[model samples]
Target chain A: MKEEIIISGFGGQGVLSMGKILAYSALLENKEVSWMPAYGPEQRGGTANVTVIISDELISSPILNSFDTAIILNQQSMDKFEPKIKPGGVLLYDPHGITRAPVRKDIRIHTVDATEIASDMDNSKAFNMIVLGAYLKVLPIVQLKSILEGLRKTLPARHHKLIPMNEQALQAGMDRVK
Target chain B: MKGIHLMKGNEAIAHAAIRCGCDGYFGYPITPQSEILETLMEEKPWESTGMVCLQAESEVAAINMVFGGASCGKKVMTSSSSPGVSLKQEGVSYLCGADLPCLIVNIMRGGPGLGTIQPSQSDYFQSTKGGGHGDYHLIVLAPNSVQEMADFVGLGFDLSFKYRIPALILSDGVIGQMMEKLRLPAFKPRATEEEIARDCPWALSGRTGMRPQNIISSLELDPAIMEKRNLERHERYRKVEATEVRYDTFMCDDAEFLIVAFGCAARICQKSVELLREQGIKAGLLRPITLWPFPKKAIEGYCRQVRSILTVELNSGQMVEDVRLAVDGKVPVGHYGRMGGIVPTPEEIVEALKKNS
Candidate 1:
C-alpha cells in the first residue's frame, strides 16, 4: 500500500509539522516513509508545503508531480494543489483561510472547520492536529494509537503535558467530520 | 538493533557524527544545510559525548578548524552548502596535502556564486574534481536517502582514517532537508589518546619523548621532495580508486538504456526507471555511491550491454563526462539536467531517456 500526500498552508500553520507527525506514525507502524518540505525563503511566513509518502515497499522518490491526498489549509495552497490531485484522490481542506472551494469532479472533497473548532476549544495551536485527525478519519492510513505515540516522539518532553489536549483536538476533528 | 526513527537527513548526519564518535564539528550556517549545525548545537554533544560543536565565524575558519582537529588525529568534520563550501576549498586542499583524515559534508545548492538555496548537484565538478588549487582528490560519497545520510557519516570517517585522506559527503539540499525513517548505527566511543597515537603516529599530538617529534606541515621548498610527495599522494589515490570504488545498480541485467546519476538526481532517476519499465522500456539506473572514484569500472561493464546511456543530474552535466569516459564510445551517451536548483521530474527524465535512445 502506497499513499502519497501533500499538506500545505502558511508557515506558522503547522503544515510541515502535520506531515512530520504522519511520517513519524508511519515509521511507528514499520512502514517506509518520506517527508519532503518546500524549504528556503518560502518557509518564512510564506505559503509552505510538504510531500509525504508512506508505503509498505521501498519508496523510490520523495518528490512527486501528483498526490493521492492533498490536505490544504489555505486558499493559496488550495489554488496551487487542487489540480495536482490524482483522479479519485482525497482533497481535505480547512475552510478557515480558503477563499475558493475546491472544484473537482473526479476526486473526493471533504471540509473541516479546523480553525473555528480550535478557536472554540481555546487551543489554537492544535489547528494542524485537528486537520490531521480529519484526514485520518477519511483514510485511516495509520492507527490513532500510533499517532499519539508519534506526538510523544515529536513534541519535547517538557511539552508532554499537552498530549491529552492535542489528542482531544484530534478526536474533536474526527467527530466533526460528517 | 535500534528501532527506526523518523528524521531529516541533515539531523541524521549530525546524530550519526556524534554516535560515530566524531571529536568535533565546525561550521557556519547556510540555507538547506544550516540544520546540520543547528542540530549539532541543539544536541550539545559537548555535554554528552565530549564532542565539540562550534559555530565558526565563517566557512573558511570552520574548515581550518577541521584541519587543526584532523592534524591532532581527531575525527573532525564540517558541513556547508555550495557557496559556503566554495569558501572552504583552500582548507580542503590543505587537509589533502597534509594527508589528514577529516569529513567534509557539502549539502550542495545552486551555485557559481550565491545562486540559490534550493537543491542542486552543481558542485559535482567542484567536489569530485579539485575545487582548490593543485592536483588533489577527496574521497566523495553520495547519499540518496536519509538512512544513507546517517550511514555515510561513519563510513566516510572510517575510510578517511584508513587512508589518512579527507572524505566528503557530496549531498544536495533535498537529501539534507527531507525526512525519512532510518535506523541509527550503534554508538561508538571516542578514541582514547593512546589509541589515537597508535593509529595516527604522524598526528600532531604532543610527543611523549619516546618517538621523534611529529610535524604536520604541507610546505616543501625542494622541487624533488615536492614531486616525491606528489607521487606518494598519487599512489594513495590509485589505491583508493582500485579498492574503494562503490556503486549500486537497479534492473541493469537486461537494460537497453542506463541512466547514471547520484544523490537526489539518482533517486529521481530510480523512479523514472520504474516508470519507463511500466511503458515496456528496459531502462535501469546506476548510482555511484563514491563520486570521486566515479564507479568507472561498473559503468564500463554496463556499457557493453546497454545500447545507450543517459546521465541525469541536478546540474547542467558534470558526472556525464565521467560516464562518457567510462563508456569510452562503447555506447552513445546523453545528458539531462536542470540548473539553478531545478529538479527534473520523473516524467521529464523518462522523456529525455526516450528522446536520447
Candidate 2:
C-alpha cells in the first residue's frame, strides 16, 4: 500500500520530526519512503510542513499536491491542508491553537488534543509523538516496534532514555483517539 | 556498509564524501544545503579519516581552495546554492580551463537573483551551457534521489579525474532537503602519496630530482596557445558526449505522449505518466541523468514512438530549449514549468500536455 502523508504545524511543534520518524520507521520495514519538507522561513514562527510517501514500490514523487493523510497541528495548516486531503483520506490533528477546525467531510477527522495531553503528562516535548501516535492509531500503517526502531535511529544515544516515554505516549494516543 | 539508513540528501552527500576518500571539503554553509557542511563538521572526518573540512570565508574562497586542492591532485569539493555558486563562476571557469579535476555540488535554489530558498531548475541553462564564461562544460550529473546523492559524490570525482575536467552534481533544494533510505557506500581509503604521483602525472606536486616542473594554470600570453588549449578541452568534451551520455526511459514502449525532465521534475513526471495511464493515455517519461551530454540521441529516438513531447522544469523554460533542439521538429515539443520556486503539480503537467497535444 502507498500512503502519502503531509504533516504541518508551527516550526517548533516538531512537525518535520514527526514525518521524519514515520518515514524512518517505514524504511526499517524495508518500505520505499521519501520525506520532503517545506524548508524556508518556516523555520522561524511560520507554518512548517513535510510530505512523506511510503510504499511497497519505489516512490515517484516526494512533493505532491494532495495526500492520503494530513496531520495538522496549527490553524494555518488546517486552513491550508484541509482542502487538499484526498476523498476518504485521514485528517488527524491536534486541536490546540486551532481556531478553525477542519471542514472536510469527505475524509476522516479525528482530534487528539496532543498539546494538552502532553502537558498533562508533564512532558511538553512529547506533543509531536502524541500526535504521531494518534495518526498510527487511526491508520496503523506502521507498527510500534518499527516506530521504536525509528526513534533509536533518529535520536542520539544519550536521549534513548526517552524512548519508553514516547512509546507510552504512543499507547495513550491509540487509546485516546476517537 | 550495505545497510539501508534513512537520511536527508544533504546528509548523504556528506557521509558519501567522507567514505569516498575525499581529501578535503571547503565550503561555506548555505540554506537547504548547509546540512552538508554541518554533517561533515559533526562527523569530524579530520580525526577519523584525516579528511580536511574547512568553512571558507566565502563561496569564492572555497572554490579557489578547491583549485588549490585539485592542483595538488587531491580529491576536493565545495557545495553551495545558486547565489553562492554565482559568486564562484570565475573560479569554476578557471578550473575548467586549467583542466583540473574537482567536484562542485550546486544544490540549486530559485534564482535570477537570490530568488528564494526554494528548489528550482532555473539553473539548467547555467549548468549545461556554461554559466561562468568562455566555452567550457562541467560533466553535469543531475540526481533525483537520496541514493544518487550518495552515489554521485564518488562518481562525480571519478569522471572529473578521468576527463581532467570539473564535474557538477546539479541538484535542487527539494532533492537536497528531502530524505530517503540510502544503501551506504563502502569506505575507500585515501589515495596514497605514491598513488597520487603515479595517477596524476600532471599534478602540481613538488618536483622530483629528475623531471621538469609541472605547472597548472589557465593564463597564457599568446592567443594561439589559448586557442590550442581550448581546442584540446573541446576534444575531451566530444569524447564525453559520445561515451558518457546517460538517461532513463520509463514505460515508453507503447507511449503516444512523452515527458522529458531531469532531477526532481522527472520524479513528478513519472507520477504524471502513471496518472495519465490510469486515464488510458499512453504516456511515458524520459529522465536525463547526465544533463551535459543532453541525451539528444536518446530523446530523438523517442520522437519516433511518441507523437509529441513536453519538457517539464521548475523554471519558466530553460531545459526546453535543449529538449526542442534534441527533438529538431521531428515532433512538437511543448514546455511546462512554474517560476519563482513554485513546483508544478502532476495534474498541471497533464493539463499542459493535453493543451499542447
Candidate 3:
C-alpha cells in the first residue's frame, strides 16, 4: 500500500526535515518514495512543508492534494492543511505549539507534546525527531533499527554523536505514545 | 544509493557534470546557476579528475571559453539563466556555425527583462527556435526533475560531442531549487583532446604549414556558399529530428486526451494524469525530454488516437506552434498555461484536461 504524508509548519520548524527522514526511512525499507517541498518564496517564513509519498510501485506524481497523514507544527499549518487531509486519515500535532486542532471527526488526530519532550531531552532542536518517533509508533512502517542506521548515514561525521541522542529522543517519544 | 538529500538543482548538476566527465565547465555567476559554480568550486574536480572549471567575467567570455575548449575537441559546457543565456547566444550560434560540439545549460527564470528569481519556462521559444540569428539549431533537452537535472547533463554533453553540435539542457528555477534523491551515475573520463582531434580533420589546434589553415566562422560573404551551408545544417537537423527526439509517454496508448508539456511544467502534468485517472477520465501525458527535435512524430502518432491534445507550457504558448505543426489539423490542439512567474498546478492542468477531453 502507498501512503502519502505532508508535514507543515513555519520555516524553521523542520517540516521538510520530518518529511525527508520519513522518505529516507521508507527508502531503506525498499519502497519507492518521493519527497517534494513547497519551494520558492513561500518557503521563507509563511509556511514551509514537504510531501512524502511511499509506495510499492513507481510513483507517478510528486504533488499531493490529499494526504494520508499530516504533521502540523503550528496553528497556521493546521489551518492551511487540516481541510486537505483525506477522509479517514490521521492528523498528528505537537501539543506545545498547535492550539487550534482540526474540528473534523472523520480523521484521527493524535496530539503529542513533542516540544516539551525535546526540551526535557535537553535538546529543543530534536522536536522534529520526537514527532518522527511518535509517527513510527503509530505506523510501524519502518524498523527503528533501520531508521537509526539511516540517521547514522545521513548525519555528517562531525555530528555523528547526535545520532544516538536523537535515537533516544525518538524512542522516548515512541514510549509516550504507548 | 537511493535516499533524499538536501541539495539544489544546480548543485546536483555540478556533481553530475563532474562525475559524467564533462571535460570543462565555462560559466559566469548568474543567480540560479551560481550554485553550480559554487559547488564546482568547493569540490574542485580539477584537482581530482583533471576537470577544468573557470569563472569567466561575462556570459560572452564564458561561451567563448566553451567554444575554445570545444574547438580543441573536448566536451566543454556552459550554463546561465535566460538573460545570461541571451548574452551567450552570439557564441552559441558561432559554435553551431563552426560545427563544434559543446553543451549549454539554461536554468531559466522569468522575463523579457530581469524577471523574478522564481521558476519559469518562458525561454521555450528562445531555446527551441534559434536564440541567436542565422539558421542553426541546438539539440535542447528539457528536464523536469532534480534527477533529470543531474542525468541530462551527461546526455547533453555526449550528444553534443557525438553530433559535432551544441546541446542545451533547458531547465527552470523550480528544478534548480528542488531537492530529491539521486543515485550518482558512474564516473567516466572525458575523451582526450587528441582522441577528438583524430576524428575531425578541421579542428583549430595550431595548424602547421603542411596542413590547411582552419577558419571557424558562420558568416559566408558568398551567398551560394551560405545557401549550401544552410542546406548542410538542414540535413543534420533532419537527422536529429528523425533520430534524437526523446520523450516519455505516460498512459497514452489508451488515452482519449493528451497533454503536451516539458521541463518542470511536465512534472505537474504527471500529477494531472494521476488526478484524471482517479476521476475515471482517460488522460495521458507526452513529456518531451528534447525540446528542439520537438517529438513531432510522437505527437503525430497521438493525434490519430486521441480526440484533443492540450499543450501546457510555462510560456505564452511558445511550443504550441510546433505542436500544431505536428498535429497538422488532424485533431484539435488547445494551448493552456501561465506566463511570467506563476506555475501551473496539477489541479489547473486537470481542469484543462477535463475541459479539453
Candidate 4:
C-alpha cells in the first residue's frame, strides 16, 4: 500500500520533526519512504509542512497533490491543507489549536486534545508525539517497536533520555482510539 | 550490494566521498548544502582515515582551496548551491582552464537571485555548458535519488581524476531534502601521490631534478601554442562525448514517445511515464545521468525509435536546445517544464505530451 502524509504547523512547533519521525518509521519498516519540507521563505510562519510517502515499491517523487493522512497542529495548517485530503483519507487534528471543522465528510477526521494532553503530561512539545501516535493507531504501517527504534536512531544524543517519555506519549495517544 | 541505510542526500554524499577516498573537502555553510558540511564535520574522517575537511572563510576561498588541493594531485571536492556556486565559478573556470582534477557538487536551489532556498533545476545551462566562461566543459552528473546521490560522489571523483577535468554532481532541492536507506560501500583508495605525479608532469608542485618548473596556466599567448592547446582540449572533449556519456533508458527500445529529462526533473518524468502508460499512451523516460558530453548519441538513438522526444526540465527548457542539436532534425523535439520553484506534476507533463505529440 502507498500512503502519503503531510504534517504542518508553525516553524518551531516540531512540524517537520513529526513528519520525519513517520518517514523514519517507514524506513525502519523497510518500506520505500520520502520526506520533503516546504523549504525557503514559505517556512517562515506561512504553514510549514513535510510530505512523507511510504510505499511497497520505489517512490517516484516526493511532491504530492493529495495526502492519505493530514496531521494539522495549528489553525493555519488546517486552513492550508484541509482541501487536499484524499477521498476517504484521515485527518488527525489537535482540537486545542485547530478550531475548525471538516468541510468534507468522506474523510475520517479524528480531533484530539493533543496540546492539553501534552500539557497534562508536563511537556507541550510532546504534542507531536501524540499526533504520531494517532497516526500509528490509524495506519499501523510499521510496528510500534520500529517506531521506537526510529526514535532511538534519529533523536540526538543529548535528547536520548526523552525517548521513553515520547514513547509513553505515543502509547497514550494510541490508547485514545481504542 | 544491499542498498538501504536511511540517509539524507548530504550525509550520503559525505559517506560516498569517504568511500571514494577523497583526500580533502573545502566548503562553507549554505542552506540546503549545509548538512553536507555538517555530516563531514561530525564524521571526522580526517583524523581516522587521513581525509582532510576544512571550512574555508568564504565560498571563493573554499573553491580556491580546492584548486590548491587539486593542484597537489589529490582527489579533492567542494560543494555549494546557487549564490555560493556563483562565487566559485572563477575558481571553476581556472580549474578547467588549467586542466586540474576535482569534484564540485551543486545542490541547486531557486535562483537568478536568492530566488528561494527551495529546490530547483534552473542551474541546468550553467552546470552543463559553462557557469564561468571560455570554451570549457564540466562533466556534470545528475543524481535523482539519494542512493545515486551517494554513489555519484565516488563516480564524479573517479571521472575527474581520469580526465583531469572538474566533474559536478548536479542535485537539487528534492535530492538534498529527501531521506532514503543507503548501504554504505567499502572504501577504496585510488592512485598514490607518486603515481599521480608520474602521470601528470604538468602539475605545479615546484618541479625538481633535471626538469624545468612548469607553470600551470591556461594563458597561451603564442598563437601556435594556443591553437595546439585548444585542439588538445577539444580532443579530450570529443573523447568524453564518444566514450563517457552515461544515461538510463526506460522502455525506450520500442517506445512511441520519448521523454528526455535529468536530475530531479527525470524522477518526476518517471511518474509521467507511469501516468501516460495508464492512459494508454506509450511513453518512456530518457534520463541523462551525464548532462555534459550531452548524451547526444544515446538521445539521437532513442530519437530514432520514437516518434517524438519531449525534453522536460525544471527550468525554461535549457536542455531542450541540446536535445534539438543532438536530434539534428531527425525527430520532433519539444519542451515541457516549470521554473521559479514550480515543479511540473506528472499530469501536467502528460498533458504537455498529449498536446505536443
Best by DockQ: 2
Give one digit per residue, the lDDT tens place, for model 3 in A43-140: 44678888888888876656667889988888888888899999999898886666665799999888778888888888878888888899888887
In CAPRI terms, where does candidate 2 land?
medium
lDDT of 1 by residue, B1-357 (tens): 147788899999999999999999999999999889999999999999999999999999999999999999999999999999999999998899889999999999997799999999999899888999888999999999999999999999999999888999999999999998888989999998999989999998788867998878889899999999999999999999999999998999899999998999889899999999999999999999999888998999987788999999998889999988988999999999999878888899999999999
Q: Residue by residue across B49-123, what tens digits does model 3's lDDT show?
A: 898999999899999998888777777888999899999988988998988888888999889888876678888
- TM-scores for all candidates: the values are 0.98, 0.98, 0.92, 0.94
Two-chain DockQ for each candidate model: 0.73, 0.74, 0.39, 0.54
User: What would the DockQ be for model 2?
Assistant: 0.74
Backbone clash pairs for candidate 3 read none
How much is the lDDT of residue B241 in candidate 4?
84
State the displacement of the C-alpha of residue B122, model 3, in Å, after optimal TM-score superposition: 1.7
Q: Where is model 1 chain B poorest over a 10-residue stretch in terms of lDDT?
A: B1-10
Better of 2 and 3 by lDDT: 2
Better of 1 and 3 by TM-score: 1
Fnat for every candidate: 0.78, 0.83, 0.35, 0.54
Give TM-scores of chain A for all candidates: 0.97, 0.96, 0.94, 0.92
* Pairs of colliding residues, candidate 1: none
The most accurate candidate by lDDT is: 1
